[model samples]
Target: MGVIRLPSQSRLLCFAFHIIFILFQQTTAERELKFVVVVFRHGDRTPVVNFPTDLHKESEWPQGFGQLTKTGMQQLYELGQYMRKRYSNFLNSTYKRQEFYIQSTDYDRTIMSAQSCLSGLFPPTSSQTWNPELPWQPIPVHIVTKSSDRRLHFPLHDCPRFDELQNETQTSSEFQNRIQPYKDFLQTMAVNTGLELNNLRTLDNFQLWNTYDTLYCEGIHNYTLPVWATKDVMDKMEKLAELSLLSLFGLYETEEKSRLQGGVLMNTILKSIKQAVNSSRERKMEVYSAHDTTIGALQIALNIFNGKLPPYAACQFFELYQESSGRYSIEMHYRNDTSKDPYLLTLPGCTSSCPLEKFAELVSPMIAENWSKECGKKDKKKDIFIGFDVAVGLLFIFDLVLLYLLYHYGRCRRRNNYQDL
Candidate 1:
């Protein structure tokens, strides 16, 4: 070592070589991010449905109810630009047909959000530019009509079993206990909002939330809220809303509900992940623009939901990676708050970087073999009746056979007696 120290140039070269070797090892050990699935709520919008008495009526909103506002457009646009920067190391500088996909819930707010987001992510460049003045190019946002879209939407309608489950949930001890304290407050809501809650359905926690949302949005947008609408009331409404959503998706028989609703989406996602891996597909990303319920439902299905509403433009990511050992792994991240990077979430039974095979196996139970069938397209009552009828028919056939055998024995005994006489 003392002899080597005599040559400064040689020592410097040796140090650089050691540093390069370490860097090379680290690079080779790093896993490669192969694909990603990004799902997000639509940005802020006019209330979905508002009370009749509210000052910010349907006419007050530019594109009517449930439409995206300028603020919403800006939110998605910024998010798109952020994504472009975030994935610059992975994604190409310009848009490619097979690199990514965008889908929405056939709603103006969500569809527009996707378009606005794409504008920022893939601004037209070089040959891609049609007009010199416009930086945007068309990106197709796919959708299935709402009624047929249980996979992306939530509180999935037309599911009789889910409806039955919800009814059961309301009667659950947990629901009764949680709602007992809020009964008076909700009655006050019924009075102040001028909405008549005559039945159990009308007395829903979700309804109270909508009423609060309307007034709150109005107040924020310069329209005066009702004098009765106070911060305390809003907070209470928000909690009730969260509870309503929870009660719907869980709080009783969580797994069954997940199989009926959230499982559908999760199954689709897992399929895409597997296909990308096995078929060596070029699909690098799949971006889904959906409602808050969609995000919540998916989280619930994965058993990773944090028991709160996912805020506006809240996003969840499922990323796939191939390790140096040639094995694949899945990782999940959630970005609900703007102030911080996405939090890495671990699957209940598996590590955050769970193997692809293990991830699929762990989640297989949640995936419904038939979503519609599980949701009660096949009648349970009919099946019971059919079984009952079959049992009765079998019993009748056995009795008939017994009666015939007894008659034959009697006839044989009479013939023997006559012959003896």
Candidate 2:
């Protein structure tokens, strides 16, 4: 056969096409989503608790404090619809217990938020329809009582080391420096908000956060702010609230604090990811209905916190993808605003799409193998035995000393009697 020489332009075009083909393949390979885990805060609602001096009362809300309002339900429902649209191809048209799971913190708002979201996520089809009047089907939203739910709760009160860490965070130079300039302003807030200065600064209860929340909620609902809560004052209070939130899980020995607070939840997520990767089951989604603190703790642990309180219905997504090359990677996205798309959250020390193995390694330190032990909790039974042993030894030493004293007194008496005789 006669050899045909291609024109120079044709040769360049062929090389360009080859490069484009390779790039397209790589892009396609990376886009195969395998599984997703969503952690979302409960939708907008009445404040969980009121401040001492507040204009709004529980009776003012449609439901009492901390309950989901109609608006809150609609927010979650829209979130569900968004999710359904986003993952249309990945999930079944109808809800399958084997493929999808949802969990919520044990609270009226969260449980109801989960339910409301499910209503939009899996509206009944003709086959699933029990009643023609209602398009919603009851889907289970699993929950453990707040006392027992360690996975979704943040700033666990049972962890002693975490408590100690908070104490240290307060004393740390970084925290002190951060709050130093705000000292006079905090005192001013204390006077205006009817809270003790010490209480406002304390990180345990996040009193500053509560103050900000009440004001923020009232403003959201069109209630007039307290005269003291001017725009500038609210702005300052907001900054302190953000600082208070950050101080709960960081600002001193962040890794150790995360191990106790956020790490627990992260460990659960990592385990779920691994199971999805290894298992043959078709489980594709896990949804967590929780609080701002829950999202904050998790983000802090991952070193990706945006330094602001997560708004109502804010969501963090951990999506697992199996590339065409057979390797899995994780991509994280955060949706804090309904008006815009979720922000891509890149894990520190890794790219936005990090290899599964590397992501695990980076987060391994925060996961607690023994949560109780790491919390510096001693075994109660062991402590009791140790106390008993110490008490018995001390009693035996006391008995010996008493016996020696008695014997010595007896000898002295005998010698005196002999001299008298």
Each model's Cα RMSD: 6.2, 4.7
Candidate 1 structure lDDT = 0.84
lDDT of 1 by residue, 1-421 (tens): 3543448888799999999999888866687988889899988888878875665668877888888888888888888887888788777788998888888998999999899889888999999999999899998999989877866988788889988988788888988888888778777777777776543233354666677667766776778788788889888877877777777777788899999888889999998998889896678899999988899889988999998888878889999999878899999999898778889999999999999999999999889898778887867788899999999999999999999999999999999999999
**Whose lDDT is greatest here?**
2
Q: Which has the greatest TM-score?
A: 2
What are the Cα lDDT values of the candidates?
A: 0.84, 0.90
What does the lDDT read for residue 275 in candidate 1?
A: 87
Model 1 vs. true fold: TM: 0.83
**Clash count for each candidate, listed in order shown:** 0, 0
Question: Which pairs of residues clash in candidate 1, taking residues 3 or more apart in a chain or in different chains?
Answer: none
